[model samples]
Target: MKDLIKESISDLKKSDGFVYVTAEGEKIDLHEAAAKGIAVTPVNPKSEVIKKLEAAGLDLTDSKFLNDLNELISLLSGSGSTKGKSGKRRTFSDSEKSKIVEEWKKVEAAGKKTKAAFAREIGVGYQTFINWLRD
Candidate 1:
């Protein structure tokens, strides 16, 4: 998975606005969304997510949306508004996963922290963050 991200994502062969991820892996299907470089789900135009995104002056679509979602989720968790911090594992929606991936990229591009640092900052295990990126 890391190889795919490092290679396929780096290649970014865009065909008709869609990137073709050709990394070879048993679970990496070229037809799947990940293999096509669609790392995030698009929010409905009228959905609350879109509204919040617009209110926050963020793009209503694409990576920006995913990043904002992660930011919001992180803020909620830190503010004690979400119970996801409980010892039990919390299931994240597809959208949430997308958000996490975007946020991970954002932090990584900043070049100030390692993967472990990011996990600690987000109150999650290092492997968990890597798993999120893997998915």
Candidate 2:
């Protein structure tokens, strides 16, 4: 029975998508696995064997399960736009702002055309430059 179960688990790992079998021999799909909060891989963790193991009362807190769950959560949540404290809102000094504005005027006078192009050259967003002009 143990060997059979192990073989089933191995088969489950090899199969595609999230699969969970209820103790009563019912199959669970990806949507069901997600709804049940089962630890599944980020790239479709469903499998028939998984469903069977789950139905057989698989340990949800198993180390491998937790690790996979954490990885999936991280992948789903994204890496975030900000990078630590350095990405926090910044307060530009008056001199820096003036310098930027002056550079922007030179670009404008030089017929750089697109505001976005000039903004890119100066390493700032076009909207940011517009906001500076408004200030």
Candidate 3:
């Protein structure tokens, strides 16, 4: 039975849509079936996944079930407590900063009040530009 369940799950993962039939012959949509599958898992999930599951008809009143479903979804999505963080913070050289500041000055002299547009022109956030001005 476990093997059959695993096989069904694998099939569901591979297919874009799956139709599930209940004992009483009620047809469940792909989203609802996915939600039911998620609900039976042993881990807690993220809020987004929980929202989707709730939309698919899972009762959020059962906290244990909701938590498990969320965890399962997070694991399946390759995220959550198990995933490692990556990527380094971007840094600008002094010369690069000077060049950006000069461009910002030119924009200011042109009487442009759109800080966002000036920031985009120099490839930085408006807040970052404001911080650069302070520096």
Question: lDDT tens string, model 2, 54-83?
Answer: 677765548887666656665567522222
Q: Candidate 1 regions off by >4 Å?
A: 1-84
Query: Over the stretch 1-135, how does candidate 1's per-residue lDDT look in tens digits?
Result: 345334433434322343333334122333576556744433222343344445656565778567656668777776323334556866678898788779989888988878887777766778888888887
Model 3: CA > 4 A from native = 1-89
Which candidate number would show the highest TM-score if scored against the true structure? Answer: 1
Supply the global lDDT for candidate 3.
Answer: 0.60
Q: Write the per-residue lDDT of candidate 3 for residues 10-129, one digit (tens) a residue.
A: 545654443345555454554666777733222212333345445666767798787777768866774443223233445789898888888778878999757776775444667888
- Which candidate's lDDT is highest? 2
Give the higher-TM-score candidate: 1 or 3: 1
Lowest lDDT 10-residue stretch of candidate 2: 79-88
What lDDT would candidate 1 get against the real structure? 0.59
Q: Of the pair 1 and 2, which is ahead by lDDT?
A: 2
Q: Cα deviation of 83 in candidate 3 (Å)?
A: 28
TM for candidate 1 is 0.35
The TM-score ranking, best first, is: 1, 2, 3
The clash number for model 2 is 11
lDDT for model 2 comes to 0.62
